[model samples]
Target: MQKPEPMKDQVPWATIGLVLLWYGTNIGVLLLNKYLLSNYGFKYPVFLTMCHMTACSLLSYAAIAFMKVVPMQSIKSKRQFLKISALSAVFCFSVVLGNVSLRFLPVSFNQAIGATTPFFTAVFAYLMSNKREAWLTYATLVPVVAGVIIASRSEPSFHLFGFIMCVSATAARAFKSVLQGILLSSEGEKLNSMNLLMYMAPIAVVILLPATLLMEENVIGNTIALARNDIKIVWYLLFNSSLAYFVNLTNFLVTKRTSALTLQVLGNAKGAVAVVVSILIFKNPVSIIGMIGYLFTVMGVVLYSEAKKRYG
Candidate 1:
């Protein structure tokens, strides 16, 4: 008897575990950063981005060095290198914008807006894929938009600028996800996660460093000083980067195993978890109506994911 062919979309339990870890740990990192930034008067998002990217780069390079996957000189194709570099810029930009938004918006507010990433991803995929959504998906789109509106209104007093910034950041993040999907599909022919990560890491650091220096100014030096004075910052930086990278890997693996829509919707638990943590810890002011709005947002995400699975 011939052996059955392996399923391409069937990820192992171990892989699933990684994806969940990615989602939960990502939420944890956000909570920790919010706490630290709030309690210690630290400029977090920017500082953390620089530290995390630098550390991830170093660790990723060390792994490549140990495994002998690609020597320093093996990136011979200028086109591929440029493409990864561009992707790195986009990813880093989104992260920076997100961190900036966190400075003004509560953690839950940022998470709620960020949850709309799937909607934007769906829109971009539909546009880029040239595929028409079914009537059900179109119907579900209404509730999803409505849910976001509801959640956005829950804030104490919305700053037009901050709201716009948060929405822009969310859209940038969505764009990054779509672009990553495209780039991964293309360069995946030649690059593994570690290689892509190793290559992109330096590019991100190079691009982000000058931007941080110009915009954040003295905040950068102060953060570095804090990092040295408190060894805990070092641990936080390591855990933040390593866990985030690992989680993203799991997200990628799970997408191969399951439907993107399923992952998007189910992964929304991150927003809910973040919202609760923010409120309990930071006391983010949320009215009853706003809480109701969050519930609707969660429900909409679930419904949207289910619809996509059926029709997609």
Candidate 2:
């Protein structure tokens, strides 16, 4: 009998489809967020973020409980609930600041600043866990930081406060990722991303409610007024909030289907695609230096991913 031939790996169409869906939801939510905050005069980032959390809370519950998409995990202890609350608080901060930055900065420029997340992630990992990356991995971040500085100077519509908000938001996001690992490192405490969101969203909504009411001036009344003038604003909020949940869902799905490193690589490309698409949609002006800087930052991110893959 002839020896059987070894089978070659086939294309993963299901994973590819999920990736495309991930890209669509991620970029769609981002563009819509920019539109609502800047062009549509929402003017209430905190409240908008609250709405997103509320939607996530409802949608995630339905997905887990009714749809039976994933096994629901319960909080085993008060300590775990507290950890989830802390993560939720951090999440609220990152999201609201991101929306506020979008109100002042062009989407393209905002994405450029957000690309520096890897630099912040590395810093937080070291500070929080005393963990260190290889020297080459650290070296990869230099261009990431430098590219943002170059882009900041060259950006046609640079806003100082916006830049600060964007950077702070990025840092907060990275901090949350690191803190999540530290807080939920144990096998018993570890929750899948979906269950984590399911538990965290309601806590985030609770946290945001008082902050939104206190920080924003007459946000509810103004939103009602806006909706009265154009009922489409109601529809827009519904759609935008729904997209926000989908963004989280798709992100979890993509990471489940592919490795985390693949997700990071896809994320770098997603940011670049978002930048190009936003510039075209919003007709934002970009200088050659700005484009070069954005590209340079993206290249650094790619190198950082590769370095992590190899060094780890």
Best of the candidates, lDDT: 2
- Residue 134 in model 2: lDDT: 100
How many residue pairs clash per model? 1, 0
Candidate 1 per-residue lDDT over residues 1-312, each given as its tens digit: 999998798657776676677677777767766656555566656666776688668777875688564454356577768878888888787777776676677887777677676678778877876657787876766666677688777678455665777788878777776776776565334565567777888888898788777777787577679878987876776777776565555565666667666567657876787788778988877777767776776777787778878887
Over 4 Å off, model 1: 1-20, 63-76, 126-129, 157-159, 183-194, 224-235, 250-262
RMSD of 2: 2.0
- TM-score, candidate 1, is 0.80
Candidate 2's C-alpha runs over 4 A off are: 1-10
Best by TM-score: 2
TM-score for each model: 0.80, 0.96
* Residue 240 alpha-carbon offset, candidate 1, angstroms: 3.3
The positional error of residue 312 in candidate 1, measured at the CA in angstroms, is 2.0
lDDT by residue (191-292, candidate 2, tens digit) is 999999999999999999999999998999999998899999999999999999999999998998888999999999999999989989999889999999
